[model samples]
Target: MTVAERKDISNYLNRPYNIIIKSISDESGDYYVARVLEFNGCVATGETREEAYQAIYEVLEGFIEDMLEDGEAIPEPISDDEYSGNLRVRMPKSLHRDLSQAAKLEGVSLNQYLINKLSK
Candidate 1:
């Protein structure tokens, strides 16, 4: 869920990366997790959402600092806005037929139906 403006990341350091926050609670009391998906294994957790956010931000800052000190390249976030909105996916003919039928039943175009499903 992180993205810097497409090619306009010159001043992105002031605007923090958008991190993903989710509930990781599983009946062992409430808890939350946060992560910078653009950076593999950069994750943090806390008992509350606010704590998780702060923890993840700290981790992100440290991660960046470490990379800079180590002379490693800092990865920029992948922005979806750069996409052309066109993708060619190859699938079985039967599956395509089924999807077309389903889209027809839902009163929506197949492309729209696929977009809706993928967005969720």
Candidate 2:
């Protein structure tokens, strides 16, 4: 890779991409898996949680490098300001009617009822 490409990867690596770590228990033993939310299919696994966290960065570097080499646009981590807190969903009419009735019974608007449900 060129110097400029390497530098670009370094800059993105420093960005605050969300890293999610989940623990799994299987017949072999317990292990931890880490994935970068911003980079689909970028994942790492290790015996310990800390190891999984560290491994994710290595995987992220590789993902960024590969994306750069392929001339694919690298996705930047989304900032808080980017979300407008509005989501439109399509559901079956029956489900919608049920939800509306439940919301009415609870003395809340459908939006507020959905928010309360999602928060839990």
Candidate 3:
């Protein structure tokens, strides 16, 4: 992936509601077949890996909404091994646009650019 694509992927991955999806495949003599092996219970699987990943997000969103409607406590965010801290912030639209543009110029997504800058 290009740096920009990596950045976008990183941003989405950092979201509290998103989970890192891992899959494994069995290697046949001529071809390999893979399936999603592990995911947070929030996501559901499909016949294909791509479909499973796509469907899981919707499932997760619905699950969360249902929990809220039932008055259950919301779950905490999951962290990746790369990052040690978690913080949430809100920015104005103008600033967000500016930052997003800057990040794109640097071949990164907003979240990744910010994280890379902040980590220095």
Which sequence of candidate numbers ranks them by TM-score, best first? 2, 1, 3
Number of the predicted model whose TM-score against the real structure is largest: 2
Tens-place lDDT per residue, model 2, 1-120, is 788988988999999998999999999789999999888899999999999999999999998888888999999797888999999999999999999999999999999999999999
The lDDT of each candidate is 0.79, 0.94, 0.60
In candidate 1, stretches whose alpha carbon ends up further than 4 angstroms from where it belongs are 1-13, 105-107
lDDT of 1 at 41: 80
Task: Give a tens-digit lDDT track for model 3, residues 1-120.
Answer: 467745644554446654445554545322212222223456465556666677776665555556555776655554477486777889999998999999999998888999998999
lDDT of 1: 0.79
Kindly report which residue pairs in candidate 1 clash with one another. none
* Candidate 1 TM-score to native: 0.73
How many collisions per candidate? 0, 0, 0
Descending-lDDT candidate ranking: 2, 1, 3
lDDT of 1 at 117: 92
Q: Using Cα atoms with residue i matched to residue i, what is each candidate's TM-score against the true structure? A: 0.73, 0.84, 0.36
Best by lDDT: 2
RMSD to native, candidate 3: 17.3
